[model samples]
Target: MSVENVRPVQSNCLLEVCVDSVAGLECAIEGGADRIELCSSLELGGLTPSAGFMQTAAHISPVPVYALNRPRSGDFVYSVLELDLIERDIEQARAAGLDGVVIGVSLPDLRLDIGALTRLKTAAKGLDCTLHRAFDLVPDFDVALEQAITLGFSRILSSGGALSAEQGLAMLRHLCKRSSGRISIMPGGGVGALNVPQFMALDGIKEVHGSCSSPSEAVHAKVTALGFASESSKHTDASKVRALKAALLVPSSD
Candidate 1:
């Protein structure tokens, strides 16, 4: 870790909760999340939230809310049309009074697409930016970390190039050290209250992210059979958020 950009140690770890609906947003806030990552289609790994969702989240969430700017599912590699869509989505986030935006662009080879990221960063000026988990797909983490820093992203939301933060503890620690104070490394993916202690144990990991969603409830059999919704869909639980915040010593609206 460079001494010059030494990351400051936090007195308490912050909890960033991901929410895909107004109900989830309310739950996260009621549960005491310090930050919110507002999005849609979380099962699709989170897509850019609708303008209405962004606006509503800004109005209701007392905590800083960062809107996911991803335009689609599949890979982060984007076409000109998709890039244009992403640019406008970012503008919408800012116009909706969001606190920040989460974004990433990748090459077909699984490396960060510097040109595309640069363009998106310019559009997101005046709002904080987070390099979202498209980072997990990077072929090289060290090179990608430097790219994120050079891009002026406030932080990188990653799982240490792994599927979950717990499984990637080693690499996550290294990233914490590598980032020093130049930027923050926020671990997400399968992180939650019960096992959050494992992640907060890392030195530079001052913040963590997760869905805090409860298991999907059984819906009417016909609902799934008719394709109204997936039987496996999960919903955010206020109790789970409160539990996590309690574990982290964060205050809640309750």
Candidate 2:
């Protein structure tokens, strides 16, 4: 790592892919992702995965597995019960020997709930805590950034409140410069190999997150003991993972 690249924590210009399935987890590892954010129900933003799944991923993943501690998909505002679930998920991830947990909470008015955030951070204790995309919903991005730093969040994944990281690149750059090494600004939501370098070249970004997905049409077969095999499979994009990794390897002039 270069001196300028020395973020508050160790920084790597690599892919942090979200895996909703065991096969996806393995694919992420095979493609050389720097880290994996394990979650379920990618269709609904993403919720906490089963403890068994968390354990299995941790046991076999070659890279760090950061379990998603979210309880639902709608808004980031959480009830007391939801908060409890988040804490429990964090504990389960720690017990499972995982790397970290990604979580977030904001006021109903779309502002940082410092108290609730502090509670979550405290619960995270020995594990790394990443403030999720909720940061992008904050009423004031700068204040939210400071609050995250004060609350001890190591990093954040955001899209500059825009629909995608590309649209939010300017704000992402501003946030990184304003961060002053206090926190890592990770860009996610619609990131890809083609744009990974753009995000990395922005001031203060050390990591980029996205799912590089492509179409695939491989048939999976099930074999029976009666010397008969049933062929059944759905199209799955198996190339995006590797392609994304390759995109990150393109060295930046900066």
Candidate 3:
């Protein structure tokens, strides 16, 4: 079904599955994901996907696809040249008819780079803009949350500055309370069927993100022989995605 045709779950909470490959896209769709974040290397915390990958995935994906806009790996801070490149990529994502773009920029002090973020949002004028996990890198969560809201991000993907949503529940809850409907605080990182209920129980959380990924031996064998690939090229498992989605849709009796 097309994204427009897919109905929201009874609970009204959204499930966003992060995927790096077309195979993973198919799995997410088959498993009834509410949305998909398209990227290349999830191991490096997700890099911008190629134009071809974005186009192909957009063409076939049943749900809306949001492209990650980071130019390179190490940090959220970008040089002028890198910012230009990121702008170009955002345009490419728009041209490819993607539903949205995920992006973030921070200073050395680990604060939101408002200037860069403004320019990037301008470049992505028509697309939904999600502030990615770069929120987790910020030194102050409250200040960063206000900054993201001021920058007009549709949502902020975060793990509460912790390694996983479970680990950061306190901060996540605080963000939701402070947001007060001005912005969305979407908890990501290590969210799964096993722990989604804990997040769902939070008062203001309306969305969640996860890779729902499982190791694929076939994928491992294909890349490991190249002498450079680690056993980290995982694919989204449809069954796992289904379980996660099912868990979110059902109300917790506890």
Report lDDT per candidate.
Answer: 0.88, 0.80, 0.88
**Number of the candidate with higher lDDT, 2 or 3:** 3
User: What value does the lDDT take at residue 43 in candidate 2?
Assistant: 59
Error of 3 at 15 (Å): 0.6
In model 1, the clashing pairs are: 5-181, 7-180, 7-181
Off by over 4 Å in 3: 1-11, 218-223, 251-254
lDDT of 2 by residue, 55-169 (tens): 9988787678899988887999999998998888889999999989998998999998888888988888989889998899988998899888988889989999999989998
What does the lDDT come to for candidate 1?
0.88
Structural similarity to truth (TM-score) of each candidate: 0.92, 0.85, 0.93
Query: Better model by TM-score, 1 or 2?
Result: 1
Candidate 3 versus the native: TM-score? 0.93
- Ranked by lDDT, the better of candidates 1 and 2 is 1
lDDT of 3 by residue, 1-254 (tens): 45335443444589999988888878888788889999988888899999999999778776789999988889898999999999999999999999999999989887999999999999999999999988999888888998999899989998999999899999999999999989988999999999999998888889999999998766556568886677656778989988999888865678
Q: After superposition, how far is residue 227 of candidate 2 from its true place, in Å?
A: 32
Model 1 misplaced regions, further than 4 Å: 1-11, 250-254
